[model samples]
Target: MTSTPHHQPILDSPYVLDLFAGPGGLDVAAHVLDVPSLGIEWDRSACLTRYAAGLDTLHADVSAIRREAFESLPPEINVLAGGPPCQTYSVAGSGVGRKALDEVKGYIERLMAGDSDEKIDKELQKLSDPRTALVLEPLRYAIQATRSPNRGHRPYDVIVLEQVPAVQALWAHYALVLKNIGLPDGTKYQVKVGVLDTETYGVPQTRSRAVLIARRVGLGEPFLPEPTHQAYEAKGWNRGNGEAAALTHQPSLDEEITPEPVTRRGKSGGPLPWVSMRMALPGRRKPFLVRSNYGSSGHPGRRGVRTDQQPAATVTGRISRFVVFEHLDENVVYEGPRFSMNEAGMLQSFPPAYPWSGTAQAQQVGNAVPPLFGAHLLSAALGLPVPDPEALREPWVPATEEERAKLRSQGCGAADDCTARCPRPEDQAPPRSVSQKKKLSAG
Candidate 1:
């Protein structure tokens, strides 16, 4: 928690409600930006996890929270956002009964609301319809139940949802719901969904998340953000392309490799320079990927630290640092690079001082929503003013070799330590010790 101008505990600033707010990542981003947020999580332990972050949260099943209650919030909400539990819809978790989704596949399949009307109302109607429209997938119905801004309910100026790309059909559902409700304050809105890399936003991890930015009429037309850094493109450097070496520090493929396709600043036309791994995580070049063999197959950190110059993958719950980059041989000595929970939090966009409670796996991964991705969408919706890119991405440096040596001296990386690895999210230990080594580093 941070102090305000008067030194009071600063809980949140952007003012959002994290419905199904698993460990409050969405809320964390809004709060880091000084946006006040109110998060709700159905899982009792999950709610306590948000409380640990100093956030005000309601621990209730989202389904049970009447839409009328959410509508009662202040009408001028800056943003209404959440990453509803996506596991049920995710291919990884959907069971055979998820066939309920197949019945409504057409609604999900309909990508375009036809551009005939404004995207907002269409989104609303799509959600409110009983036909099980997949436009918003499973979550749309919940969103529509809330009163519209016009109805004196908790009217939102913007809405943001984070999830995997498989939920694109859900995006269409939201558009239709907004259309059904018509634009609030006569402020029309446009919705856009894109794949965002945390590294681009300055986090060392290469986590990719689906981002949706909805801009209200007065704010200005929706726009994609521009990239602030460049990853080294090896092909250009080797081909004698002017300034290829200067473009990025990431080692290129054969000195002539092309970089990941990206819009400059998350743009549509040009690719933005990628943030480098060493530049991103600073000292994590050789750490072992540790885990407890439970969540995420046991990657030991949030936004698991990226190396080999690749983009960091999305940080997820049920991940354990004890699992990453481990040798397969049962008898091999376990000396190698590994990430501390603090390192994982840095990659996930949490402030260094951000207190994560609960078990190690639950606390770190649960509280973060990649700040880079959060800023990416907000900037687009508000026609973002110029930002100090450095300020937004407080870069993270790994612990020095000496620090790692000490962790190794302890029980870490030993085959014996690996034997007792806990599988439950709440039963894990800190990478070596739980003390985080840094303060907040990303926007």
Candidate 2:
């Protein structure tokens, strides 16, 4: 589906082409920065959410649609960004594992051997695994975009990619390959890849992801965005403040972080306190406790109990299972209240009142890149000015009375004394039944 923008797009702004756009997380950031963009997505649920949010989208399989599909875009593409579906590569997923990885590498090698698409398709069919190879689709587009600059085409100026940290090795390999290809101008791309902690970028969640950035030749050295927020665990590993080190908030190990007013905004003494649940879900008061659904199991660890004082653990699609816990002397109970979709969206830095549609609201939120962090990556890719996080506020909720009421309804309680337990059992997905087995896919 080739859909046009629901809103007028700025024709002069740098254009961002997003692949596997999910629910338009990166596009949200692009919009905030006034960068016109179009997302290519295939998932029906995610596309509905994107459309509801008024994002321009083209619904199609990235692998099947090829570069010819993007000919309508400006000749000189400014930015290329994508987060390929990561089912087979996620540590949480059980799939073809390392074997699938090797098969993908073999497939790429054969393609380089001048193997025809029909032959490759048949061979991939025999392997019975496709998602592992899907990760290379972005690379395919990049190569095609820059292949004929001499023939009146302009290569994309910047490229950005992200995936689970487990896929870091794959990205590093791509970085090397991208560095070797000369564009029409005889300059190669400068590439860099590393694991980025979302908390360090003000995402309000401690999700670590593999990030890759590449700038076309002549744009100076490629570099990752510097961390804009202080990490809670900084005291353990970062000890000294050398001259060359970028400034970061490093609390003393003995220092204590008490809960501040949820309304309190702006930085106090150091980099803005790593965003916490309190700031993201202001309705939930102190001593906040979380409980998992029916059959959750895990060793005692700081996984389940999310306090307003700390950033949340990585949010997964199974978030509904985790709820607020009420403790009273010897009795512990959960009264069926769970974190709302709005709260989850805030944790992911999505705009307030984001029109999240479809039954997979939680899944869409879980899969998106945090918009605040995404803005940082985009800025780095385009060598643009970094956006002030404070200036980027959610458009609704807490601010909107009607939305605030909805958020309150989903919370356990608003009492200051109501807090979740610390270190509750981790909520792992139940094992899939034989009937649940299907081809792998990514968000």
Highest-scoring model, lDDT: 2
lDDT score of residue 255 within candidate 1: 40
Candidate 1: which stretches are off by over 4 Å?
1-14, 91-154, 176-188, 217-219, 230-273, 280-311, 321-334, 360-368, 386-443
- 198-295 in candidate 1: lDDT tens per residue? 56555545454566666544443444454444533223332333222323433432343322332235565444556543344544433222323332
Name the TM-score of candidate 1. 0.57
**Residue-wise C-alpha lDDT for candidate 2, range 195-225, written one tens digit per residue:** 8878877877778788998877676666787
| CA lDDT, every model vs. true structure | 0.45, 0.63
How does residue 131 of candidate 1 score in lDDT?
Answer: 25
Best by TM-score: 2
